[model samples]
Target chain A: MKTYLKLAAPMALAAALAPVPAAAAWRLVDQGETRKVARSTLVVTAPEEWNRATERPSSRSEVWTQDGIALSELTFYAKIKDGETLFKRRQGKRNPLPEFDKDMLPTDLVEWYEDTANIVLGGSLFEIVEVTPATLAGYPGVHLRYSYTGGDNVARLGEARVAIIDEKLYLISFEAPRLHYFDRYIAGVRAMMDNARFK
Target chain B: MKRLLASAALIGLFAQPLLAQETGDETPEEKPLPSAHGYEPQDDLEKGLWYEMDEAEKSLKESRFLIEEPALNAYVRSVLCQTVGDERCAATRLYLLRTPQFNASMAPNGVVLVYSGLLLRMRDEAQLAAVLGHEFTHFEKQHSLRIFRQIRTKTDLLSWRSVVPVRLPYPAGMATQLAVLGSVYDFNRDMEREADAGSIEELVRAGYDPRAASAIWSQLGAEMDATAEERGHRSDKNRNGGLFATHPRSTDRMGRLAYLAREAAGDGAGELYRGAEEYRAAIGPWWAQLIEDQIALKDFGGTEYLLATLAGDDPLGWTGDLLYARGELYRARAEDGDFAQAADFYRQAIATGEFPAESWRGLGLSLMRAGQKPEGQAALRSYLELRPEAPDAALLASMAGEAAS
Candidate 1:
């Protein structure tokens, strides 16, 4: 999965996915469940995103997590390889995203997305149900229709329609409401993805 | 009363071995795994986490009796300690916490402490094993002290958003650091990548679906996302805890683990070790509380994800009650005038047979919210007739009055 993070999505995906699921093997890999996105890497990777996302190119709208009443931000770096693995920089003032202290900390879809990116390349059939074939950018891709179920409710309070394009496992994914968001932004998403090349 | 007594007695009696004399690793060969960065099991950090595997054994002996209800205790311990009934894995001693939160932890000494909320959330053995697998990797890879040292140092953090400056005083005390640790206890980023990889194998070795890891991540994501939405934020930090902090992210792990789970799929004897009915039967007492707690917290996403996961095991007929619960959740939401959407949930509840009485009441509530007074009145009446002694009878009746012509 970290391999996919390298933008060598396909090859990294293959390496991450091909292994057998075994506890011993996991011991062989590494162990830390703290997962947060590194924005510096993203910013470094794509400077245009800041301007495009908030329409505030001049004022950098650094992403901040709303913790209780405060919005704290980090100088995050996503491009770190095992070269300077997490262990080397485990302690410092800069708190990692998704603090690993609590037993059940909140994780967003991005973490799952990164994890699944590796899975997608792992060679198992990630069956997409209720989806259609679509061109996202120049890369041929598929639209995924997924539903989320909640324990407290009978009606699925959530539905996600995601548009995606993949070339050798480097995925360009766009998530929006199945009813409107996906349809509305798919073209822009496609263009953005098409415009993107490996950084 | 009997169950409680038996539990107390077990806690008292079984706690003996925990107090008994035990041995430690005096020899170089017997040293515990080092948890410090660049430290190996044979190193000093390992010494910190494994001060006593023997003491862990002692604790297990003492704690065995803590869960007095033999069957429940034994079954739960079996699920957590035993490696999916696999002969290849050793049974580790797991501690039971008295906390009511949703969580579990693994001591470096192989002591696994499971939270009651975990049992409440899991619908089957596979899901339980899925979580256990993640923890098992912690022990197997000896990550206990690795993270401990990482937190002590207060290190690397990851985020998709731009890094904003957080002003901190020089050399803060352990007190503020501990609290900050709770919020931002940074573990080595490598450990996160390790867990992602380890979770894959742990699930496979345990005879559970490794993919459950990805599913769990997705479930976790939805839960947090939903809670944030409930609490009013497009990007809330309450939910992005440990796993997300470690590194890469669940997104990448999904792809990595998917590859891992696939290998064992073709193995002839590989059936995921889970049965929803059996899971419910084991922890029947805690289900309602778990559902209610998560709901009260208004974590619709996690709630929904949990229900869906249970529903996926619908072959075991466990989804009906969950479906009903979901309907009630929507009724509670009632935000941005989503009453009609809540009404649809009631219909599904009826379709699934979850909570007949409440689903009817919720249907009425949704109807009234959507301004269908006549139908809402009839629905409330039906609810009252169905469960005249319901806990919310007064409220229901008042609502009924408002809806009535």
Candidate 2:
């Protein structure tokens, strides 16, 4: 368990800025149970119990948080087609977010994610620390480790696994504040990514 | 936390205003305050304000947003020292933040922040000194404390006005309320004007080209115009009412500064220093990173305008770095026909043989997107050879072919 009360004020301010739903929109996902996610053809078994956020970043993404989102959150993107973005476009935004391309190589995907992170984080503080060949659901993919400071000015570490199959993209990403939460939950996040499967 | 951050941002937005009441006559020169030696809080109110700034400054030192490059830090601090004397410069702490916005700020406790975007936008040392001098003047004049007191007093007055109603006609009542609100902004506007006039005197005294002060505003105004034209809307300066705005429009400031510069330069003045070459040399090593951050802003039109303007300054053709920047801009935008544009720019940059090795990679990707397969594959092979240990080398190698063809 993580400490939530210590940073309640800033966390509450962050929640206010986010597209949070009513209290009931948060659901519990029991450990060791497989479930479909994000209204897409992806399934995964939880390595631990989590509070699932229905107000996800995008239509094809689902968010699961162990503590508050200000601490740690895992997200899954499933079946993102070409020309679709990772998050919904903000109305009247002058600079459009980068869109997925079917012909994107593993490296292109990593660059695309970095661009998105820079836009979302609202600065140039995002840095990609490492990139390596990996597999998602036993298929070739790329894994990326990165870090960025959020709007709250807190440094967070993130890892993502991305793979494109049949002109659709699948991504699993986990992020948490770099202080203590990232190290604590990174292993479980990796385990969940290893076990993820296409339904 | 929220209020403190908001106030800091508000302070950062401080700039001179152009009031309509000004006759074209030159405003009187502003005398600089005495050297800040052993400055400290004189009262409890100031002490409280300093305490808040101290906390902010502590976090600022550790912020990931800071550009901690030693050379860059020293170069900027040297410029600040030139703007103010070394004595006053010692009393201020300068931080270069990697934010893609044209802004700078000085806090009550003498924490000065110059955003990276400001460095990228400035064409020469004179222009940079103009801004740095302005910010330092704010510190010397204690604008932050005065502004704080003004805001507190106004807030108290506003509260009393809300409860103790005075009868007035409909439009009269609304105008009266607006007048009260306008007074707060007007006070800030006056502070900005003083800082502006003060900086020009200092810029001239330091032997910099005073005209460079106004050139910064002209370039910024042009970029704002380009952005508006691209977005199909009225420019922000057009939409934001000058009365409600804390600072004057960029065009207004540009004209005002030009007038002040002319007056300060006087007749038969010797050629003053712009320091363009020195500025370029100081910023050369960080060019790629600075350009990357600017492009990441995704302000397509503004970036395009800025790149073209920079290219215009080159005596010959576009520099290899500028060409690469143009290619990156189009590639990142990825609109229809952008891939072809990107490929052309990348090709031009590669021909110079002074571009980053990544130019080959950019060329390959752009060509691939434009459906030029064999050439694209060849370019990709070249990139893999040049950067065999790149993080994406294996994937590019697999895409291009088994080996160099």
Candidate 3:
């Protein structure tokens, strides 16, 4: 009986460490299944099983995480209207997020992300390491790669792919700690991006 | 009553020469400052306060935010020593931090934290000396202990939580720490006035320009006004936000400092020095990084004012960076036709041939916004050619392709 309890103890701890899905907020995303992302105008097919976070679904965005937001996060933005900002609205601020403009260039998109990281997110150190052009949803888009030292003093790396289609903005981004988490999930993110489609 | 009146008259007699000095019409003979040495807290409460501050100092020493550049550190220490005299300076330990806020605070234990933003704004050694002297006076006068005692008396529940640990995790924790520091240990108006008067006296005695005190305050006022104007709000007469926000408006502070400067300098202003060139040379290597930090705040009006102020001093040396910064400022503002203005600045920056590769990308975007598609596409192609491995290269190529068609 003692040996059985010892074996069960390790199993219990393992269960605790594993990602626990909030019954109402999350649904299992099976491998090779194409599913519509909440609030976004696009759909994605996961190459593997993943958890979709739906705790706070809005008309503009959605979040998916393998571990948790702290480890890694994949955020999607649908057809964000011209003059609208990404993410939830905040109050009592002079400058909110830069409003999306129909005429925004890839450079403008990069600047917007920079401002979001430095000004909105209040990073201690934010640097754009590279900027290149990419295709998203069969449309020309910008790919921005940046790093920031977050308030916690942990270094983080982020990549964003953004495009303007039919005067609306579509964005997909991944952020994770630069240690092991960023590289660990980057391949999966790229695969997911490869399978992403807009109806 | 007769004795009090006589003393008041005597004070007025002493003040007259100082007032005359403000107009550069007369000079008062320099009086030797009292030797500052062997300062120790006499009371139990004061000793306890010092002990608490010593712990904070220990934690601050280990903070990653502390700027550890030996040259910059030594330069600041030398200035503090000059201002306070070497004997008293021995008791103070200065730490420079890279935080982008215009503040310098002295702990009761003689640990002074000077923020990078303050260093960026100071145009000369005299200005920095005035600020350092003011903080030094706060330490010498035991203002923090008095404030701590008052708060302790008012709230029994004030806990150790107020002293935020330096290693606390990211953004939320940092915000809480900053908020706590902002609200805690703020000295009363009387203490601030005393520090101002005492610092000016120290500045003059240290051979720095007395007028630099008022000049710093005036610049702060102008920055505040510009910020207000840019936000489309009427400048508030009472809006005091930066270093003096807790003390008084810049106008009031400037008025008092100007009066005191005259009193302190009298006719000896010519002997004093601003040390502008020497100061610039000392801080030269760090200036560009400091300016970038300020711009990262996205406070367009304040940054614009700062660039203009620095440009006025050395336009030829500052032109390339200034033009690029102006383009960035206009791009962020994003008002109608602001893109065209931004494009023009980028063009000027590119003409200098010393601008960052990002300038080419900025020019391309601005041109596109201005409806010059072909020119914009050509510039974008140039950006791609220069930065072949840029993260956004694919997108730029696609745009260029569309433009050609």
Candidate 4:
């Protein structure tokens, strides 16, 4: 019974706890370069070189990775309005993905995200480890840490920062397989989070 | 919502047993099929299938979804051995998967994949044995090989038609193709019926309750109906024996099996075995995980029905485990007034002497959500006391509003 909500270590400690493929469709974001994402409402300065995936997960989301998305990914979700979901809708899907609600508290939002991940990841084994109050893009929000085994059944770790401002949601999330990838890239993810801002 | 990833991709490597309808032929139990030996392919087609199946078995062995718990595997294998003779069990390799679906599939190469979700639905060893017996019959009767040959013949016919210069008009060609497809399904349905009859015979000979077969089928049918009702869809109970379904309708299968069970019990010999306590003991450690997996499917109606049935079946009264499972269910669903319902269930679970420590944690969360912060924090503190080394201890303490230790 590994219950939920372990308080995460400080970002500095997480930095202590913590790869690459070039593809035809992927573009490189050089170190120290600033990139606009999610229609320029959110921007991040690359702490290191990273590959940006050509196809976004959704219109409001941009994905970056050092390796393939399967092994590691950093996603940005911007200005998602109430009554909308993080992913595009699929017609005639038996169970529709839950929509975002403007009135959701940070805890409610985290629960919703866990439900979404369980549904989207093709029946993966998902668990939430921790959720804590935090500031995201200078707005009060929540930080979440979680783990899940996807289609490949590889144990993976994930972290996300989310905030609601003016009834619109903005989120930044990073995930990687728990072995060498998570520890190796966690510092970079933390630095990128520190560098994230409202454009 | 079991992933069914590897199993699905392997295609013909596995065969699922859906209970069968009475086909108006002689009951297969009246003349049991000869037992299958360790199969040796005697022809090119058989050889090809064996080779393909062997490769599929290799993939299944390395699949990440395989539940490698030795004790659990041994327990299930023991039940399978009890259902079929030990010699027959020797020919099969059982693999328990972590999937949350109600299914068990036997491959042509003697690989049996049992999904964990099926265990949740079963009340006792008899039901488990019933399902395994059905799958074993499929293997013993060489239904996969028969189906393969049938499919091959159909493919050959289509190929010959393609190469022929003479082409039938649109409707005739379409009808021909439909007939080919319909014949394959019909053959499959017949094989299912044979497997059902064979399983019932084995159960009787093994002295297990033959009625367990029909009981589980009925339960599954209700669960399916509950799922459909939850989704705001009309129950398709009146459909014509599910013309395109791989197995017959559950009602048809259940009714026929019940009839057979009564015939088998005409003399009603000494007490038949159910082994309910034995089944509960074997699954006790993993029950919570199974419940979690099922709830994650978000099938609230189905889960609620299942939990209610589980509670109703217990002669010893609702235990801590059942109470806590209900709490977890309501907590996860998080609908209107669910938090309060979840809190009450958690408290009831805690009142039970042998409750899970997570009950306190759930109580804390539910209470806080229900705006009872003081009581919620107290419950959180109690959980921390019980599970001092819990992975999320520090965070829980923080939520409990405790000073840094």
Model 4 docking grade: incorrect
* Candidate 4 root-mean-square deviation in Å: 9.4
TM-score per candidate, in order?
0.46, 0.83, 0.79, 0.81
Put down candidate 3 lDDT per residue, A93-165, tens digits, no spaces: 4444567788787778887767655544443366788877777878877777887654444567888788888
* lDDT per residue (tens digit) for residues B1-405 in model 2: 665333322322221122234323222346333246777786686787777677667766666667899999999999988878788888888888776766666776778778787899888999899988887776777765665554444434333222211111111111111112111222345667787887898888888888888776667767767877877756544332222123454566768888998899887346888898999999999888999988877778888889877776664558889998999889887788998999999999988889888889889888887888778889998898899988777667766873344
Per-residue lDDT of candidate 1, residues B1-405 (tens digit): 553332222222211111212123233545533322343345575564455444334534443112355676677777754543443234355544322234555555555656555666665776777777666666656554444443334333221111321211111111111112112222344554666566666656666665556665555556556545544655332223333322334566667666666765556525566566778787776565456544443345556656766566464544546766777666544455557877876777677655556778778767876778789778888988988876445545655765354
Question: Best lDDT goes to which candidate?
Answer: 2
DockQ of each model vs. true complex? 0.01, 0.27, 0.18, 0.14
DockQ-based ranking: 2, 3, 4, 1
Best by TM-score: 2
Judged by DockQ, which candidate is best? Answer: 2
How well docked is model 3, in DockQ terms? 0.18
Candidate 1, after superposition: displacement of residue B220 in Å?
2.9
In model 2, what are the clashing residue pairs, if there are any? none
- What are the per-residue Cα lDDT tens digits for candidate 4 across B334-376? 7789989999988888888789999998898888778887888
True contacts kept of each: 0.00, 0.22, 0.30, 0.06
List candidate 3 segments past 4 Å from native. A1-24, A92-95, B1-66, B155-184, B233-241, B313-318, B348-361, B377-405
Off by over 4 Å in 2: A1-31, A47-51, A54-58, A103-105, A133-141, B1-35, B155-189, B238-246, B250-252, B266-270, B313-317, B402-405
Alpha carbon lDDT at A6, candidate 2: 14
Superior by lDDT: candidate 2 or candidate 3: 2
lDDT scores for all predictions? 0.42, 0.70, 0.67, 0.68
Q: How far is candidate 3 from the true structure (C-alpha RMSD, Å)?
A: 11.7
